[model samples]
Target chain A: MKKITVGFLALLFLMTLGGCKKKEKVKVIPPAEKQVAKTGEEVKEKPIPKPVVQEESIEDMSLEEINKKGYLQRIHFDFDKYNIREDQKPILIKNAEWLKAHPTVKILIEGHCDERGTEEYNLALGEKRAKAVRDFLISLGISPDRIKIVSYGKSRPLDPRHNEEAWAKNRRAEFVIIAK
Target chain B: MRKILIFMFLSLFSFSQQEITIRIKGGIPAIRIAVPPFIVRATTQQAISAAKEIEEAFRADLAFSRVFDPLSRDLIALVKDRNPEKPDLKAWESVGASVVFIGKVEEKGEYLRFVGKLYDARSKNFILGKSFYGKIKYRRLMAHRMGDELLKYFGQVPIFTTKIAFISDRDGNRELYIMDYDGMNQMRLTYTKGMEMLPAWSHNGEMIAYTSFRKGNPDLYIRHIYQGRDELVARGGSNITPDFSPDDKFLLYSSSLPGNYEIYIYNLRTKQRRRLTFSYGSDLTPKWSPDEEKILFSSDRSGSPQLYIMDSDGKNPRRITFQGSYNASPDWAPDGDRIIYVSRVLGRFNLYMLFLSTSQVIKLTSGMAMNENPCFSPDGRHIVFSSNRSGKYQIYIMDYDGKNLRQLTSKGNNLMPSWQKINYRR
Candidate 1:
């Protein structure tokens, strides 16, 4: 039940945020009243349509709408492992939904490794972790085209201390907005 | 007068102190005592054994242990009236010798003969000496034999003439190449159009094992240079970084067979492949310890890349680097005390060395160009690595201290250098 709720929230959040985007509206108005004809004629008022708000429909809204808003998301793995657990799917799905809502937005998924193995192996391992998240997104009906993934490979850490909690946070995938 | 006396004392103090360096053989100190010449019957074919040349080599080779005590001897006097085949003990004892080395050298037109002997002053018996044969190029072998003689005299193993097989892009692309201890006369052993990279010379040096990315996927292959042929070793997956065991009977490599890169060990004799790492994170680049008891590799189990080491049986895996934000591709030193790796600092890559116990970090290379792959020479006195310092990627050699830089290749962009281990096989 929690997984389904988390997944629904992620889908909704992704739909609303849409990551990163930019837009601007320009307005030009004709002179309120043309100068009255100098030949002793009264000035005349021009009629103008009252400005009305019209919803601007957009097909690709995943990336742009989410740029202004930020998210704090985390995925956990078992000790000495990098696979995303079943408990973390709903959490990730929530973020994916927001991405789908705003197509213009782009996101970066950073994969990390714990401090268990050699540094090189950890780097490659981190890459695999990040790639795992990428594949999951595509599986969730999220287009792979909107996401960029990179592995820190055990270089970056959420906690510097050597302990279970620190490693748990270290073995995670993070999402960041790259463009709007 | 007082000032002069103080000055004399300081001068004597400075002169009394000496700075010396000696080589270690099998991590043990070998003494470097000079052995002079010995006189033998000039007409005999076996006149010279462990001759003067071998004596010098013995002294030098013993110094490798960093534990030799030099005793200067006069070759002319030792051999002037003595026959090395049988020598009087009294003459050598008169010199207050802890040990005495006596040898004879005979010259016959274009041919030569050598006989050598080592005597223990305490036992009054021959400790070492043997006859040998070889040409000028193999003269070093004669010295090495004397080294063996000295070691066996002290109950130690002798290591020389071992082969080192490493990946060199000196010719064009990264390919398997072999060379002597000093990186001299390197021969290109692989001639495939595709890259035969990360060549790890088998512990025996007779076969070179590496990852060939031919056929669009990485595969492990072992080649015996003399026969000009190779054998496939892995079952499937992009197998790379194949490091052989100390006995050359097994190999440790990285494979992505199960949809993610992981570590595996393949027994050469048994033809069985064993998976070593099962973490969800991909594990790659496994290096065997000097004793083949541990494996070192890189992983992203953390958020970023770091260096890690595990046991030969894939147990008790621990992280080795904490200071660096990025560290990978660690090559263990033959002496088993130091590990050289590539560390990324501020978006730039360079070579680094970490002392095992102290973890004292030493940056070996610093330049604008990327200095990624580093390999230690067989003697551990020098290292060769790939660098772009010359505006192009090329192989460069430098002293272990990062001095005396020399460009080994000037053409083509060469990279991914893997130094072959060649200190004991021969």
Candidate 2:
């Protein structure tokens, strides 16, 4: 798993420069320039130094450890809407910060809905809500495999009442520490 | 499938084969039952009415249950009211009562307390033991409780504690009214001065999805029953018959969004709406199957009102009914084999059933007034429907096979009953 992740990260980094390297090599092949650059390369040939960047891949992180450190946050969404908004970016960032700070951590987001419609609709709605949170996390450099999402729809409501306050409270997405 | 079904069916077949000493196959057609008036144990003035009122409540309850032919109160009326322990069992038997009821009452402060029992006349066995203690204002509730217990005694689901959500004009305008399943305990669920109808209950029992005409068009609104909180769920064209899925995850309902009425599914998670039908005629009154594999709905798509079924994903559509000239509002039994719907066979619209496996159609109701909107109990053994058989629109419940026909309410025009699921907490 570690080797595959390393290979995948390397591939992603290579894909980023694959296009620019072709033009650079073509321009450097002024044969005349290559000979001079070759002489310079020989002078500097302690070894061709590989560029290094401190990029942390989520694969190495243990969710159980992060959970033990108490760094989990729930992502909330507007009613019936699963698309994450710009305003909610900071919330995801905070979660990302916690995840990035505490490696080897994993999180699960359980999606819920207010009792406004049928159960099937709520389940689908809950799925979309949790998926939206997961997608947003992935875009923020969090590995897709790091987050696990499940939907409870309107069944596991936080408030079991027939009131506005109760409904609002029930329509939510909850984050739980699955592994750290 | 065959072997599994045979095993399952044999298990069901074995239970209904209960031994009967005295054959109940014949006689005057009325189910022989005896609800003997309660003899008050209390020696007080209020006890006289307290026990009698509870008895009267059960009388109405059982009589409407259609499961029992309550023994004549007149015969018991002449026997002279007395203390609880002094009833002559022989007197009840003489009146051809096959079953009997006995009770006693007490006064605890301003409240009334009562305990009762149902005795099988033939077996001479106590079938049910019921007790109650409540204020005078709650006598009816006490009575409903007794009635509900009586129903359970005879293998009937107690619907007295259940409720009905229907549209009514008692307030001079059509608004959503929630009443006891027996048509008592009436309260207004929606009082916006707008018309609300076709109320459907959420499986979790907290919310109600209904059609509200407050915006001058039929729109779906989800309203909390207790707090009276409501949110507009879906808008546009005549939206009606919102039925919740088994898991309460999605809504299957009818809307005229595509020029004519068609069933649609609205996913609460994704806020994505998908149209389920695009037929040429009106498709309305969509009911979810117990397993949520299919939906039973009424559609004029094939000409007059007829029942149709389609997969939960709106594929593989087919007609499940073909008998009656008109059939509408079909609710699938909890077991998912049979469908109960309102059908007009000989001019009167009454409850009927269509067996999906054998294509056998059973007309559960016939004659008298119009019966509409048959909602099955959570156990699927009974169905509560609306009818005008008792001179006014009132609610009635009957076994799924249409054996017991009992009137629930006689007070006002009550229509469209929605049965709540069994109280899981209790």
Candidate 3:
């Protein structure tokens, strides 16, 4: 497993280098004088340095361990509303950034609701909430295929109490790392 | 499906006619009746206990019917006659009971025989007589059958033998369970280890369709309960709130496969599905009209959830509810004139009934507790629903007018009850 990941990272690095080198060669050739300043062999053999991304080594972590890091924060919604609250947008944006960083990670977004709505309608509401969050993440450049959604309806509650504070906490979309 | 629905419609029409006549006759001051202890002719302890259980269960059924006002135990003890035959009619009439039930139980090896006789005390005439024979373990069933017979004799729909399917988390997870209408003989049906909700019973009472997350998604599953078989119906997205068509040939449910919740009908015979609603909002909990021509569902296309009706083939959709901003979980009555639904007002959910002909609404329950998933009994005289008034959700039953509220479950949290009528003839 470790060797496969290492080889995969190497292949990704080589692809990125090839992409950078092609753009430089094209631009230099268009400026005919610059192309002549460099020899044909020099231009062809030039290797572009890869940009470094500061990410902790998570390739060796299990799905459960990676999820325990809590990289993705759960977003909240208003009562009976699936639209992401303005205050919750930042949480989704951060979640999208983390997901973008972990390109190989796949996640499940569980939409939940409070005890205020009926069971069946709350189920649909939960799904709508999850979809709303999933759509926002996709708008932020997260692949839709990497984000799966399920609605727990009002079955799973974060706070078992029956007050406004508890309900506000219950109406949320939780993120779970299913694959890493 | 059309043929089956036509036959059912015919039978239901005749049944409703009987209901109207009986309601008019016995509307004021329900029929006063007497239920004395059964005379047991059994030698073994098992037979005697079985006889006692059957007698108690039968008495409970009659009292729960609300059609019969059972006499007090003191009034029944005034009579000395225990024999079903040759009873003193004068003594029963003197006790102010219009009708009297006399029963006898006999032990026949491993089987038990029950004989019940209903008689009119004023005219001293026999009204109905039934004899049921079954194994000793089916004492409650035998009692229910006798109660049904008495109900049938009174021109009322027989609901004593009907069963209620519900979801319970008593065994550590929400699973499907079923019990008698009187809350006896409770049995667990599913062991999915995942949450199961919204169980809808087929008209035949041999199958139940529900949504389960056993495979990590809310998929529709049909349980052929008697055959010990199961079939996966809908998947690929969150599928929930399954309602069996009146003909039991198709399932009306909602799926988010098209990126939003919409109603769909799945043909059980052909294994095909057809979308019913193309709303940009979520449409869930779709139920069929009694005649199977119209459909009732909840949708948020109007910016908030509300009840809507449309043709079964998904045409000419119209909004039926305009009073509430959030109304959902609508169930049509067997009479095709009344509908029961839950409406959220001020963050509290309550059950309400709508009269389609008059366009009038009546509040069935009032309190701060959440009352939801109200379903009519197959007889259309009573309703079964789940309420959290007791601190945790438990199943409750009440009359159509919302009287005589009784809690049916006490273990854990129970919700989403669907009551179905079983044809004993089958």
Candidate 4:
């Protein structure tokens, strides 16, 4: 009788553990599926475990420090142009690579413009600039869910001077880490 | 019976003559008038100073109307010693005055009573006489009321009681502020740490809508001026350049959502939004026609910014301006016959008025500074705009033909002036 009871107790414990594991799987699979569906990818790949070195470097650093360290470089555009230039492409590629290595991070892309245009039009133009950068990042295999865009129009200028050089500097797309 | 008939005919003839004189004086050249120093019946220093302030305000209002040529300060000083209640008609006529304004102030307990009279210098008869009562702190308002009465008597629209809403960065941030039409009694409306721009007054003058960055993104907010309450109208994107419809039933604005910027109208009562423009390029700064039949806006669909007009339903979009590569900030005149906009000429922005009936463009400002964001007063007889002529952006008011130019604000960068409608008591 004692032997039968021990066997039944061990079987019940195994079933309970299995039930918990199934629940965990249910919670984790939908996000991966949604991401794959968004990108229209067929491969079922699990999120890579964060690398030791990259994790250590970013684990203690705040968002401000990470941005200050220039892990993500700002991209510039020509006057009234939201298209990515040849020179700006490499910087975007570098930013995408950083984003890919840190799969657990989410970033915000801010679009800004100079004071030459009307405020309302500049706002739309800035959003286009940010969207261009975001699309480029998504094409580089960074999940679209990891990036968000907001435009500052001509309200916040990096350089307050009213000149060509200042305007060129003012019109830019900056990346900020929102969460890691 | 014959004597009675003669008396009736004489009275009718005199009435017709008075009407004819008023019509000719208002429709033709400006009326010449002289303003003498006001008389104070009180003994206190405050009452005396209040009387002088009232006199100054009355003179300024008349001069601003552009329909009355007040006597020069030198001529006014010459008639200073004459009694205001019984002004020396000979002295005023010597200064070429056709009319004169006489005023008296007396203390009445906690209130002050002002009696003002308009006299015809040639006939030596009072054309109009009125009395007003108010607290000493409200002396300017009392004077403004008197000025409006005088304007009505001369067959001109009263502008003294109207207020101008504008954006100023005086408090270390761009915020909404309002002041009297003549630039007195300035008050700040929004105390946000972020930027507020493009203030639009409702037709009833009870509420204001503006774009504020208080929530880290530019959003549209409508504020009840008297209640001090504000509600977010739109969020999550750049929403700006809001204007209340003529009926106050909808708010027309531009929003960047789902794609590029497009004009959208928000129904005030239903709380529903309907997109008005769907162009690939940005369409912004929409102003509803006074009759609510058309919308005037700036669009860059033709590779450069230009003014465009469309029906209120966003159909039959047509281009109205073709002269400049950059024509923007179009505000339709209150009468709906002309449109005012800014154009870049020789790399400098200046205000231009385009008569819609004839397609005639007239440059309203020249060689002052960058003048932009011009709005029409309630009667469409005047325009208020912002200029950087004083080494910084400041609000300015000028007549419809760009005459009577006066500065309204001096501190910080003030821009985007919107004139409120006259609030008449029902």
Model 1: fraction of the reference interface contacts it also forms: 0.50
- What does fnat come to for each candidate? 0.50, 0.00, 0.88, 0.62
* Candidate 3 local lDDT, A1-180, one digit each (tens): 999999999999999999999999987546544665775534545545559787677798887888898889998888878888999898888888888888999999999999988887788889888889989999999999999999998999999999999999999999999988
Off by over 4 Å in 3: A1-56, B1-19, B23-29, B81-83, B422-426
What DockQ do you compute for every candidate structure? 0.19, 0.01, 0.54, 0.37
Worst 10 residues of 4 chain B by lDDT: B1-10
lDDT of 3 by residue, B1-426 (tens): 111111212345564554233322323335788888888999999999999999999988877786788899999999987666778888999999999988999999999999998889999998888999999999899999999888887766689888999999999999999999888888999998988999999988899999999989999999999997889999988888888887788898899899888888999999999998998988988988887899999898989899989999999999999997899989988878889999988877899999887898999998999998999888777899999999999999998779789999999999999999432222
Model 4 regions lying over 4 Å from their true place: A1-56, B1-29, B77-83, B86-94, B122-125, B367-369, B422-426
Docking class of 2: incorrect
* Per-residue error (Å), model 4, residue A143: 2.9
A-chain TM-score in candidate 2? 0.59
Residue B71, model 4: lDDT of 84
Residue runs of model 2 more than 4 Å from their true location after superposition: A1-180, B1-33, B41-50, B73-100, B118-128, B202-206, B246-250, B266-281, B324-326, B333-338, B342-352, B362-426
Model 2 reproduces a share of the real contacts of: 0.00
Name the better of 1 and 3 by TM-score.
3
lDDT per residue for candidate 4 within B63-164, as digits (tens), equals 777567888878877764587657888888877889988888898866789998899999989899999999998989889999989877865557788888
Q: Which candidate should be chosen as best, given TM-score against the real structure?
A: 3
Q: Pick by lDDT: which candidate is best?
A: 3
> Over the stretch B148-235, how does candidate 2's per-residue lDDT look in tens digits?
7876665554766666676666666667777666556777776777656778887777778887768645588888777779867788
